[model samples]
Target: MTVQKTEWPDSLWRSTAEPLRDFPELQEDIETDLLIIGAGYTGLSTALHAADAIEQIVILDQAQPGWGCSGRNGGQVHGQWKPDLAALQRLYPGSQFDAFIKTLGDAVELVFDLVDQHQIDCQAQRAGSIIAGKGGKAVRYLTEWSKFWAETGADVRLLDKHASTDLIGTSHYDRSMFDRRGGSVQPLAYCQGLARACHERGVTIHGDSRAVRISQNGNSWRVFTAHGSVKCERLVLATNGYTDELWPGLAQTIVPVASMLTATAPLPDAVVSTLLPQRQPVAEYAGVPAYYRVDETNRLVFGWRGTVSGEIGSLNTAHLRSRAVRLFPQIA
Candidate 1:
């Protein structure tokens, strides 16, 4: 896979995120108790958790923190797995399933807790999440989905057509499941905040220090980069979708899919007043896969699958624009 450059991409998140402090490139050979490759959420979160236990920890990334999917993703903090409750019960079995469900439910709360504890200013909002649907099939699925979560003490409700229309400012969806547990955030800012917390906790982070190779060195593992090498008793590979050949078969284990997003300029007051006035993040299962949420500036950021090549142009974003227009013609 081609490595991304050190420069950040032209994204709505990058344009709005708070400036991140620069980390130096690794230059000299070093040794640490733990070495994490990748500065995204996984790596940063791990480093933060391990800081109190481990004496020495180092994080290495090819680019600045939050320069990949962690920063570029849709900032929807939603819970619940893809499988339904029945399937999960069969898969996990008895008390294991209950523990799993509790974990899933607490996951969203954990995000807010971290934000409060670390004081991350990523525009964290707990307004709620709406999964809109249409037709009888969607209605049946969402009804069951809402019941499954509500039984576990989730603040969720099923909205009828009239209620869904009033909440979403569109009549496209006749039914929707609203859960108070989910919300939105400025993804890049959140990542930056995590990095800041890790930095303040004395977790050494090196940008532009891509791990090129890894090998077992007796009882320890040594990782090689362009300029330096690190030897650590514990090593973590947190490179998510950007996984490369550094670990041989690691990249092949997961298929990477490209996603694209486009944001409209801040809308007129009249349009903003009616378009997602509640400031809820929304996902639609009734049509093509799409998710959208309004930002602090009132721009509606819409996202969907992109081309396999990951190219961005008018041709690629036309669908996103059309969907937005269809939902709220007043914007056009």
Candidate 2:
């Protein structure tokens, strides 16, 4: 039997994202104060923020800008990380838990502020978000989680089963935590819009210029691309999930896991009214987590964890849709 190569899934973001000016390939050696590798959210945001102080900032991407994980994410503007207060308390005790929690709340504000300041047209919605608790055990945990935030003056609240069912259009969940600052956006469009903003601020971004190698050259570091190179005082490797052996033991630190999502054709208004009516993004908290949102054009996009190399639209991998249908039978 011959080994057949599977084609990669086409991205929904690329189809909906605003047109971005194509960046030219880097062709010659260049010198800059800071060299940022990977022109996704991290790299672009770095260059944008450093523009006011740093005179020479350069960004290089292996592919087109924002063509990585930043463009492929669910676009939920969430504020918390995986670690809860209990976990942080266990890890840091009295040292950094408060600061960490503060940062978590501050992050959502920072993201929305950036979007407002730049006037990015990425179909952004600030209608809020919800984390639904699946099963009775998860619902108990959800109540505890909500209380943890509520006691700290967070605007979060615990929604009862009735409230959650009405809001999420599903009876599968009995509890949920509602966050006012939560929302969703066009992920690729937002990244593309940010690229434009960064470019306008004099950040030089080069596409199709993958960093082949990096090394210390005199007092500065040299980041080498296939056709070009950059000499800079500081080098930032922001190659997210695509990170490789460029820095020894760096990639191993992050446990890489793959996520897959499927989008339905634009649902009718009558149908959308029954699901995500207020446009709040909903994430299910259980083993093998899943999340979904009402994206632009009223398309209900759903996602879940899966194999790294599985093909999209495959029957074996289409469990997400089946699960989604089970949650909201009205979706049919």
Candidate 3:
């Protein structure tokens, strides 16, 4: 059950200059205390946290580590829950939502702490994040959201139209909210760092390994691949959007979405000094929000939501570039 290989994007931070490399394929049978299916952020973080406690741990990836979204994210490490506070309060009510929010905040701290402790060197910056407003309705929404976040002990400030223009150096946004809890990262490097840490902790990482067939053998489960099979007591399905065909109906509830990004040649230091001078990342509140950031080399990397066809193979870079120019006409 060999899987076709796909070329990963050449990340500025994860290319040859970086010290991490892809792991070898699984050639022999293996047994472990825990087996992690995906090598993305969630799976890698889980493995890293449990590495000290678990003696035998195995991480398997159909592709390589950081090949998926873990390497290809906007890298905005925002400490906010997926479901909004209102929705969480409505569903779980009272302390449940509060506890969830607190947990998410703690997770954000844990990510930074891990990076500092491991010395990941992923160009992590603790600047902040800006949610820019496009109109009057946007202003109202940001104001309300800022109030909600403030209640949760978040350091969020609502910037008026004038203040927003002054802060972002553009009149495109009518207002904005600044949240200090979020930051940017070189996502690919971060994932590679996690892989290295896992390896150092004696975690067996197998790349280019695809699980073609999975079956329950009485009390134990068998995960079959082309070269070998893993018979384990427990199995974790951590393949987010890429969990297709491996397990039937496993991703039925998740609507896989695609996003497109484009990077320009390294910008001049003068341009970087003037634009996003504070090194903070910016994202809009449009139906399809656009995110932009400056990499360590000062290159402008931007991306947006792509067409939703249940799957994404190739991305439309041209469209994303056009949007980038629209946002920062000076760069055009």
Alpha-carbon lDDT, every model = 0.86, 0.82, 0.78
lDDT of 2 by residue, 169-215 (tens): 88888898898877888988889888998988988999878788888
lDDT of 3 by residue, 96-115 (tens): 87687788678768878888
What shift in Å separates residue 26 of candidate 3 from its native position after superposition? 1.0
Deviation from native of the Cα of residue 321 in model 3, angstroms: 2.0
Model 3 clash pairs? none
Could you give me the TM-score of model 3 versus the true structure? 0.91
Ranking by TM-score: 1, 2, 3
What is the TM-score of each predicted model, taking all chains together?
0.93, 0.93, 0.91
Q: In lDDT terms, which candidate is top?
A: 1
Error of 2 at 141 (Å): 2.6
lDDT of 1 by residue, 145-173 (tens): 89887887779998999999999899998
Least well predicted 10-residue stretch by lDDT in candidate 3: 78-87
Ranking by lDDT: 1, 2, 3
Compare candidates 2 and 3 on TM-score and give the better one: 2
What's the true lDDT of residue 181 in model 2? Answer: 73
In candidate 2, stretches whose alpha carbon ends up further than 4 angstroms from where it belongs are 1-9, 307-317
- Relative to the true structure, candidate 1 reaches a TM of 0.93
Judge candidate 1 against the unseen true structure and give its global Cα lDDT, from 0 to 1: 0.86
